[model samples]
Target chain A: MNKYRIVIEPGSENSNYWKDLWNYRGLFYFLAWRDILVRYKQTVIGILWSVLRPLITIVVFTIVFNKLGNFPSDSGAPYAIMVCAGMLPWQFFSSAFSEAANSLIANSNLLTKVYFPRLIVPASTVIVSIIDFLISFVILIGLFFFYHFIPDWRILFLPLFLLLATLTAMGFGLFIAALNVQYRDFRYVIPFIVQFGLYISPIGFSSTIIYNNANIPDYLKFIYALNPMVGVIDGFRWCILGGSSHLHIPQFIASVGISILFLFIGIWYFRKMEKSFADVI
Target chain B: MRNPIITVENISKSYILKHQNNERYTALRDVITNTAKSIFTKQTIINNSKEEFWALKDISFEINQGDRVGIIGRNGAGKSTLLKVLSRIVAPTKGRITIDGRIASLLEVGTGFHPELSGRENIFLNGSILGMSKKEIKNKFDEIVDFSGVEKFLDTPVKRYSSGMYVRLAFAVAAHLEPEILIVDEVLAVGDAEFQKKCLGKMKDVSSEGRTVLFVSHNMGAISALCSTSIILNKGKIEFNGSVDKAVKIYHNIQTTNKNQVYTSQGINKEIFISETYLKNSENENTLAFSHDEPVYVVIKFYANILLDDLLLSISVSDFEDRKIFSSEVLISKVLSVDKKFGEAILEIPSVFLIPNDYKLNVGIHIPNLQVFDFIENICSFSIVDNGSEFSKYVGTDIGCVFSQSKWAII
Candidate 1:
């Protein structure tokens, strides 16, 4: 029996938007759980796909980069293990961005019929991706044992960077999701972006390849960090490669700054577009 | 008047309808071509190709704390748009509204029901979608299960359930919501007769509990039975707002003038098409209003592109609620041989054997009563008034259909 006076005027923004989001947190939780459950509900292998998907990427990257392209691993770490660490964050980002971008259109029925904070749809989609990230974390541990290369104290900083990566994905995701509702051409653009992202990110090879390679220039390295995934992949490798790998400070700071910037811009753009979702979607 | 629970002030909603384009989504290539074309041409192609449509226009009303207000309107009359604005699913383009207490809307049954989820899981899911918390759902969980009568398959996926069971379960969960202001649309039309009755009874129970209810339905019978006051919309404007009887009366007379009398079968088979239809009384005056017991003629002027064989025409009359009250003969009609392509058929009634009410005509063409060639439903309507006949004098309770003669015996 929560009682409050509600006033609706044309072009009036709900001042209690953030508060209402908290009130509808139960819906957010339920929607995320529903998506996760429905995702694997009919599949025979069930949750195994979460693990197998990432594992396949790890093997493909290891062969293509280490064996074929003659890429070096971080010191004593096996190439596969190094690739797994980088693949985890990259996979989480790409999937989170792609799924979040499609979330509003995918739930068009709910958008048209019900009223809640429209932010919950894209936010819940990101949570489903986070669930996938947690499931794939299991394979990362098994990879560690197979290579017998234990991460050091730097691994304790993993949670901090993981939050950063989530924010980066979610920020860009909100912006893209807003645009997708108005123009479905983003549907075709999304897969191409995700595919192009995989090559630019240091998922298969090490970020230090740009650092040590004599042919690459220093200024280009700064531009490389602008990709955001460069710093995250490098940070993941630093934590897993332990004392042998060095985390670059200037690049890491730039990634964090850009992620925060995008997060704010994403929130602003998403809020502006959220009001028109029912009309356009 | 002093303590109204909901107050709406001059609300209007408009939408811009864009012209149809091959590419609905603007790609980079489209943007480039459009820009180059604009540079070469004098006028830009963005603004002129759109048309503004008003779905709701300057609608204002108020509801007392316990008023069970019914919004009765035809399709495209802004009923759904008003509901959406009340539910805050979409914002109005103009005006203001003030609402006291929590408002919950059942716009559609099973709004968020996932087919992959179990019935038990979907209950909780749908409950939260209707703005119920987990603790609230837990408290009513057993009541919902008992009401739905799907305990035997609670753990099974809802996709496996029949459409009846799915809607039943969904309605059961939504019925448990305890929000103080309830907004319900035409959701009861989905379930079967008994379930629909049950839902109506439940809605009555909810209204009697002192909650303000806003109900929207096209069923005039249900509206008159449940709601005392009604709001009628016509062409995005409120035509009437008063007692349920008056609103239903206005709605019954609203359809005939707006619908087409001359239906064309374009892009359809042209073997036979009815070009025109009208009514003529014994006085030979063509009109839609008639007096009881007067002889009436329904004229159908048709054109045949080719020789149509075994052509049969059937006509039926239905009351305001769309119930078929009376119809012409169901048997195959006598085949008529016409020498000309254009001919007219007339079904003459000796006397208007109908109750004093408004009724719609449904005309159809068939081949020897086997296959229907062309059919039009509720194409036109007319009102029959009592003209001081003995048939209209006996008014105790014999108002089904009028017959000129009847025998009554008193022993």
Candidate 2:
């Protein structure tokens, strides 16, 4: 009974927010489960689309950059394998970021009707993206077998990079989702970010191309690392290609710092705007 | 005495009603242009379009355990805003509410139901959205399915379901929620009449189990049948809060007084017009309120500029919710053979015919099936008080709109 006692006042929810999140964990899982189930319901290919999207993209990148353009593969691993490794995290980040950004408006009915942690909506969308990430990861395993390339002990550190990518996606996702509720203009902004981020971040090609090329200045590389996906993709390549792939410690730290910083900023802005979501949305 | 399970203190909510050319949402382009205009023209454009409207103002109330409280109000009278504040869907602009025990609010049926999800899946999903634990939903799964009567199509997606089946399935999940307090909006308005009755009965059972229930509905019959106490809200303030009978009576009075008792066609030019209309008693005195056992007369005076054949005058008596009780139609030629240029039509509704409630009249002059000369909706308003009739004793049970004097014998 004491656990159930609730005091509701203007902005009084801040004190019980995390506890509410913990209590509504069931709703969190159910929403994620519902989205996953519904996503594949009507389509014939269904879940296989997750795998096909990244596999096809990586194949095109390999042909365009490696076979046709004669670009050097800095990692020394097969260009297809290197591209596949980076593509997995990039796909996960883009899909997760976009889906989480629009999740609040998509579930506006629930926003106005029920009392739960509003964070659950965007958080659940990230989980859906994680499922897609896992499905596409299957392609990476297939690439490994086709090339007969064994990843070294560094491969075990892959979960650490995945966690970093999740944080980066969530930070941006939560920020835009809350802004979308208030300004609705952010809805158009999200797809643009995804499309632009895909090109700016190192996914189809390697980050080493920019670092090793003398024509590109040092400050330019620093600005490029500011895009958190640069670090995430580079980290994935390092884990899969082992010691041969250069993990630039300075750029890596810069990216990690930015990811954590965005996470805090996103959460701060989201919490500030969450209480008014029902009214404005 | 048991302590009150819920205590609200001077709660108020105000919204900034932005007059943005009727757009429901503000666009960034508008904001940017407004900012640019302000900078260039040296005038603030945003403040002129903003006005603050208080949906609720300084409302205070307390409810003891096991109380069934009904909230009654006209449209936009802050009823929904109050519910949203109490349910924590939206925070009040000021003040506090302290509540004991687990509280669940069903502001709408099928709130989070996915159209493509199976009925079985929706039940689980909806149960959690309503604040039930997964295990709790699992335990009540069978009962929900059985109550909804959708056992044969449990695996079928709800998009394929008939609307009746969908509402039932959604309501079944809500009904099985075992919260200490339940707040329900006008969800009972859906489904068929028999299902509505069942929902009222189920709510009564929940109240009997020592759980608190707060209901908002336009159906006065449902409110009287289920709620033990009631609150009447008028323009964001509490007008009255006490026994259900008194609250309902106050609501009835509020409706009639808000409109005109005597209706007249002021500035309209028509072929036929109802010049004046009013309700009168036996002594030929005009009145807007009546007891259940008193005969009432609706007098309508009309003048026809051009005499024509096939003129039918209809007087429809409907409740505040616009549910028509009955409409009486009279063909002018069949009833009277006098001059058709000027006439008066009087409708006598006998004693014991109407139940105790507020009602309005819609007077229309039209051809039998062709055209309408004049149709005035809510031409006048009237009320029939309880008068301590036999139906008054069954106040917390469904007392239908019409009264019957038929005799019954025990077998």
Candidate 3:
């Protein structure tokens, strides 16, 4: 007889949890596909909303921060393109974070009824966020053509920061999603976090502007690098804006460190809270 | 000896039931403030505390391959909790469990079905949710659609399908799940009777293939019909574990004994409440089972905290099907008043004219037609068996709610 053993004990982590997650990869596919398919089933502008949102946000930020506030772009960068570059990562992070955060409650039926890894639900939500990111990235290509600006070889390094941005969003998403399962008021707190993050994350303006300023203290600039998105947005600007917004090596390494930290902590917290999800969700 | 397919060793589940007044949906704001306050005062003062309830208490059982076991119990008797623990939906609070094969459970039909998805898409979706790989589902795709009899509308979203069609499709996907062990809850109750029969037959086929099955249901007939062995659960403990017949009998015995004295304090007005209600034989001794000829008395005890008048006592009898046979007051024309403010009142039936069947009692206290003071519906139920009376001797004559004794002549 071909025997597979499963032993369940109180307060003991299943040794096969990661293996089981791999085994249930099919469930992950279906759940993500279902969310994407059902997301705009009845809407007229379905997938277009993905690009429409970032386009509108980019326009608004360019007008308000560059034209109205008279903030100068990096020496070689266009104001609109700089904001668009930053908006790409910011939109991905915010959308992915909120989607994963709400995933458990949205699929509470599946959570309570089935035995697949609860991580699959939020992970799939993050996948949907990635899809939206890809769609919105198309708008950035259009902006490049409108400005007759061809990005330099630094664009090749874009994937690294994109990965960083994804990990950072996923890490925080996992943390918030697990917390949302217990304290539902996070639903109200997410918008506040996203909105508050918009101003602090160097999205509408350039981080190089902060780096180039002589009046600001060096310690304050170092503290600003603590935001994981600082490196991500700086990377986006460096690649798409050419050499205008240079990557600060020290701050970039710090941001990468923080992203990895968030990734590890998020997974730790999620797995710790996962066992009780069905009981309390 | 072959290894058992499943073994549960002293598994228990305890649930913290929050009070209705407390917000069941906990918010982060409250948790944060509460923590901050507790930190400042070095004290924890919960405004509305919660109670811990043991849904399952040290339940242990083992099932060998091909053993079709049924779990019988009353509502909230931990039957569902046991299945959930075994399915890994909820972790056991204590003890351990061991299994030797792939187990697929359907705690509810259409568990992960999205009404917005088409039937064909949902088929694959449901199958994958139940642990079937994409390739496995693809292989069984035709069979599943065929069994559900929904091939014609496979492309249509399930929300448009009739409820029966939805249930049939859901059950077909679930029933098609091929696992070494199958665990099913009372989800069978969702399908129609014909679909239910088909499901039972399908389960039998699976067991005949040397697969183990654990079925939980309140339907005694279904339990005894499908399972060779069964366990009875009462108040989170296994009361009996033996043959299906004996286990079901013990279950019924438990229910009858446990439900004999039913009391309800949930009423519109707490001024007068039905504190206790029970069954009694002609000798005025309490009993749950009665004879055909023996007079049965409904012993009612009530308590009034404040002075009351024009208090009416009434009872309405219903057959096993919950059809109200008749309802009458103590006296139709005269308004009945409480003689004793707090005491027992015996309403005697000189001779039970009812056929041999179960009957439910609905008691009420009212002030004539002005308003109802207290009313408890289906508070208690009792069974009457045939005692070889001329009318009772006609076996299978439990056709009506009330038994009427009348003289019949040749003319």
> Highest TM-score, which number?
2
Between candidates 1 and 2, name the one with more favorable TM-score. 2
Residue B101 lDDT in candidate 3: 93
lDDT of 3 by residue, B81-113 (tens): 898889898899999999999999989999889
Error of 3 at B324 (Å): 14
Candidate with best DockQ: 2
lDDT of 3 by residue, A12-80 (tens): 988988999999999999999998989888799999999999999899999999899999887567788
Per-model DockQ: 0.41, 0.57, 0.47
Model 1, B72: alpha-carbon shift in Å? Answer: 1.3
Name model 1 segments beyond 4 Å from true: A1-3, B22-32, B256-411
Query: Candidate 2's error at B283, in angstroms?
Result: 19
Q: What is the lDDT of residue B273 in candidate 3?
A: 70
Error of 1 at B119 (Å): 1.0
On a 0 to 1 DockQ scale, where is model 3? 0.47
The sequence of per-residue lDDT tens digits that candidate 1 reaches over residues A205-253 is 8877787778888888878888888878888888777877888788888
Ranking by DockQ: 2, 3, 1
Interface RMSD of 3: 1.5
Chain B TM-score, structure 3: 0.66
Off by over 4 Å in 2: B258-353, B356-381, B385-402, B408-411
The TM-score of predicted model 1 comes to 0.80
